[model samples]
Each structure stands twice: as C-alpha cells, then as structure tokens.
Target: MRSIWNGAVSFGLISIPIKLVNATENHSVAFRQIHIEDGSRIRHRKVCEVEDREVTTAEIGRAYEDADGTMIPITDEDLASLPIPTARTIEIVAFVPAYRIDPLQMDAAYYLAANGVPAAKPYTLLREALRRSHKVAVAKFALRGRERLGMLRVVDDVIVMHGLLWPDEIRAPDGVAPEAGVTVRSKELDLADVLMETLGEVDLADLHDDYREAVEELVAAKASGGEAPSAPVADRTGRKVIDLMSALENSVRQARVARGEAGSADVGADADADVKPLRRTAARKRSEAASEPPPSRKKPARKTAAKTTAAGGAAKKTATKTVAKKAASEAKKSAPRRRASA
Candidate 1:
C-alpha cells in the first residue's frame, strides 16, 4: 500500500490532496540469466562506452537521443522547473462520458487515496459527483518525468485513475482486419452464436493462469526431487472440413452435449455424423411412413370382388362333375344284376 506519488487533484477551485498507488501487480514467474556450461549466475553491469568502466546508479542520468545519434542530457532540475501545473498536480481538464475513453488507450491503473482528514470531504464529493453523473474526469498528470493523460472514475468508494495513452500513440488498424472480399454466411453466424451461448458468461474470478500454475508445480517438483507432472495431450484428428453446413450442425450438437443436454451424442467422434437436425427429422418421417402398412385403395377392393366371383364358379363346376360320376356308377351295377337273372 506504499504510495508512488504524492499529488493534489485540482477539481475547479477545490484541491484534494491524494496519494497515488498502483492498483495491479505482476504475479508472473521471473527467470534469471545463467551460464549454461558453468551453472553460474550471469550478471550485467551498467558501463559507460566513453569511460569503458562500470558505473553506479547515482552516476546515471536521463537523456534524449536524436536521429543524428546525439545524446541530449536532461537534468532533474530542468524537468521540475517546467512551466506546467501537471508537474506536481493532477489537473482535471473536463468531465466526459466514460465510453469516450477508448480501451486501446488504457494503460496502467492506480488508486487515489485521500492523504489526510482534510482531503476526505472533497475527495468523497468528487467521487460522488462522478458516480452520479456517470462520467469520468479526464486529467493530465506528470509521472516519470513525462505528462500522461488519465481517466478518473469512482471504483466503489475509492477514486481510481487509469493511465491513458495519447491519441497519437495509437496506431490505425489498417491491415489488421481480413481482406474485404472475404465474407461470413448467416448459417456460420448462427453457429457462432450458439457456440458463444454454450460457453456463456463466466465469472472472471473463477479463471486462473494454467501456464503459471504449471510452472509453479514444476518448480515445486524440482525443489522436492520429485518427477514433474505431465499435462495430458489432446487427441486431435486434424481432419479438414469439406462441408461447412455439416460442420456447423455437428458444432451445435457438440455444444448441446457440453451444456449437459440429454440424448446428445458426440458427433465429432464420427466422421459420418455430420447431419442436420432438420434433415434427420425428415428422414425419420420417411422411414416411419415406409414401415407402416399401405392404406386400402378402391382398386384393391375391386380386385378382391373379382377373385371371390372366380372362386364361386370353380366350386359349382366341381359339384356338377361329382353328380355325373355317381349316375354312371349306378347304371353299371344295374346291368350286372340283369346278367345274373338271365
């Protein structure tokens, strides 16, 4: 909580004494250069080219280098005597909407603390004013011998100042975007929307740096004389998609599966699984129709009637043949009896 700078915020006629402290810190792992062959620590010393000797910190000073390779030495007294109010004060230029500040212009952040009891009232007043107006105060302050633009806004009960780069410092994004001839289809956008929704809004606090954690683990393992843990490698098929429509369909299904939706299979596992839901539904309907028996038609009914008539005629002819055979057998028996009588 050490203050880097002690300055006063000039708000109209009100001067609020505040202490500037960095709002963020670097947690990344630091590495030192070493001699690989000797396993010894490597050191770099600040040496002057003209003298060809190492110099102490007190001997070093600031200078501006010109295009002609000439160094123009600048003294501390010269910088302090500069005719600018921002040299020792944060002078508010104007109050503007916070959205007017471009994110690309944002740099380091700091929290402004009221220096003493006398500054508390004015500090709180400015904080409340900024909160009520829903705007930020654009200010100019000198830090590290250079004046920088800053946007002042209220964070909770504290007044936070975010360092902003000058408009001229930002480069125009001319060739950063894709060429004009390329385009995106509505279908692709729909899939992208689904993917975004599937990922959803995440709490930033729940996230952490995986690489940093791994590095820490590796260092711990080395210190303990233990085997370093190996991270699992993902198995990628590296298959190039030939059909965008199918790819989008599979992506939607995969997203649904990831969101814990029921009856969703991992279509990414099967190369042939790239099927649209609408097309699948239509195919299912067609298969169901094919499986069911056909309906009774008028032509089928007429054919059945004709078949019944032919069956009746065949039965009558069979009956007539049977009666004629019986009459012939009786005549044969009578003739045999007459022969016996004679």
Candidate 2:
C-alpha cells in the first residue's frame, strides 16, 4: 500500500517514525453520466458562478468568506505558514481501554508502518504493549492544517489509527432515536433471538454483495449480445406492512430457509433476473487531428513560390525598361543641344 502521510508516533520521549497508509478502499463499480439514446459520454465543466462561464484552474483561487460577505483570497504560502508544528509528530496523549473509544467517534482508518530499521523496535514495543493491555492510545496530531484526534491500536500485528471526531463534532441523539417505550412482544423477541442464533458470528468476508454482483451480471449478459435487456420493475403496489409479530415470524422462517434448515423460500418470476448494480483525469487534450482544422489541403504549393519569384522578376524587368527609356530620352535631348553648339 502506498503511504499517504509520513509521521512519527510520539510514545512519550521516543518517536517511532512511521508512514501512514489508508486502511480501506471502496470497491463498488462507479458509473458516469451518459446520454441514454446516443450512449454519448456527458462531460462536466467547472463553471464560474459570477462570471457565468467555464474557467480553468489558473483562474481559480481559494478564499475564506466572512459572515459579512467579505472574501479573503488565500494562497499556498498562507496554508504552509499555519501554526502546526513542522515535525509532523503524532503525540500519544493517553492509553485507555479499547472499549472506551466509541466506534461512532471513529472517522477514517489508517495503517502505520515503521519508516526505517531504527523505528521498528520502538514500534513493536508500542504495538505489543497495546495488544497486552487491551488498550488503545489516544493520539493528537495535525493534518491538512486541522488538528485531529485519533485512536492508535494494534490490528493484524500492525499499528492502525482511527481518525476520531471531536466531542462537539459528535451530534447529540436527543431527538433522532425513537423513545424506548414501544411495546415489543416476547414472542417477537424469541424469533429475533432465533434468527441471531441461527446466523451466529459471520465473517464479513464471507458475505457477498448480491446487488453489486447482480448488476455486473446483467451488464455482462447485455454486452454479450446486442439485445438490450428489459428493465425490472420494482414492487411498489402500496402493500400495507404486516403486523410486527407476523413480520418477525416471517423473517425467522426466511432465515431458516436461507440456512437450509427449512424448505426454499418462494421465488418470484424475476427472481433469477440480474439486478444491475444500481450504484451509479484526463484534461480534455484537444486531439490535434480532430480539434484543429484539417491542414489546409489546398496549401500554396512550391508552384506558388515559383509564381511569387516570377512576379518579382517581372517587376524587376519593368523597372529596367523604365530606366532604359529615361536614359534614351536624356540622350536625345542632349544630342539637339550638342548640334546647336556645333
């Protein structure tokens, strides 16, 4: 994995030089905007709001706007001069039990690798300590001009850091979650328990992304033959949701069928139909041949150059003839004066 950032894990006085790499990546297939009828790719441009025209990077600048609508243009120099220490030291503030750090507070995950041989020993020491103690080090660091809180823990025999949200950043769930006074039947709870027990502990890797797989299959099937597949219509007949007890019972039955404990669940007519994954840099280099006007096919040839030289020759000849005519006229007038003197 390519290291995105290079820094040190400040374990007290010892700095374990390490490089940070992203822990995860999105594998979902992405689709771009395309015209349906023509299959033409639609390109987007960065247009200036005020100018109402497309603008290039050279025309753009970063700015900070005030509450009063005042925009202060900022530069790279300004960002570099921010008060973050140049050392890029990730300070281990404290070690607390891993359970103390809420998963909701975690933002992004990154893996840290020792930069060199010297840092390896200290890095291993910290990793082992955290592993034995069942604790995660709370780290404080600055990245991209912002102070960040992170939890450092040992994962897969390597040190991983989860970027954390500040206390104020984590919003209160006061009004979001429904109040727990809703009556749930004991029977429903039993069914839920059965479903959970049946499923047991699932390895995340064992699960298949059915939607994505179906989408890919549909695309492949369509592409194989020129025939465009018919779109699958969603079941939106406005069916009323069944009672909670019935729903729980139905879910448990389905789960049992999926696990092969019971008979197969009823399949619809379009059950086998592939559902195409519904997930939806190149500088536009002007193709010289296409973008430019085809080289003037009627280019002035070498014959044109010869014509120009001939035209110059003709002009020179005309000048010589005029000079000769002037000289003859002077000679004729001088001859008459010479005859009168004789």
Q: Give each prediction's root-mean-square deviation over alpha carbons.
A: 17.2, 34.3
For model 1, how does the per-residue alpha-carbon lDDT over 1-342 read when each residue is reduced to its tens digit?
999999899999999999999999999999889999997999999999999999999999999999999999999999999999999899999999988999999999999999999999999999999999999999999999899999999988999999999999999999999988987655455556666666678799999999999999999999999999998886556555767766776666676777776363453356554465533344445555676889869888899999999999999999999999999999998997999999
Model 2 lDDT on a 0 to 1 scale: 0.78
Which number leads on TM-score? 1
Q: Kindly give the number of clashing pairs for every candidate.
A: 0, 2
Clash pairs (backbone) in predicted model 1? none
Runs of candidate 1 exceeding 4 Å displacement: 262-264, 267-272, 278-342
Instruction: Give the distance in Å from residue 323's predicted Cα in candidate 2 to where it truly belongs.
Output: 99
Position 3, candidate 1: lDDT: 99
Error of 2 at 111 (Å): 0.8
TM-score of each: 0.77, 0.67
Can you give the lDDT of residue 113 in candidate 2? 93
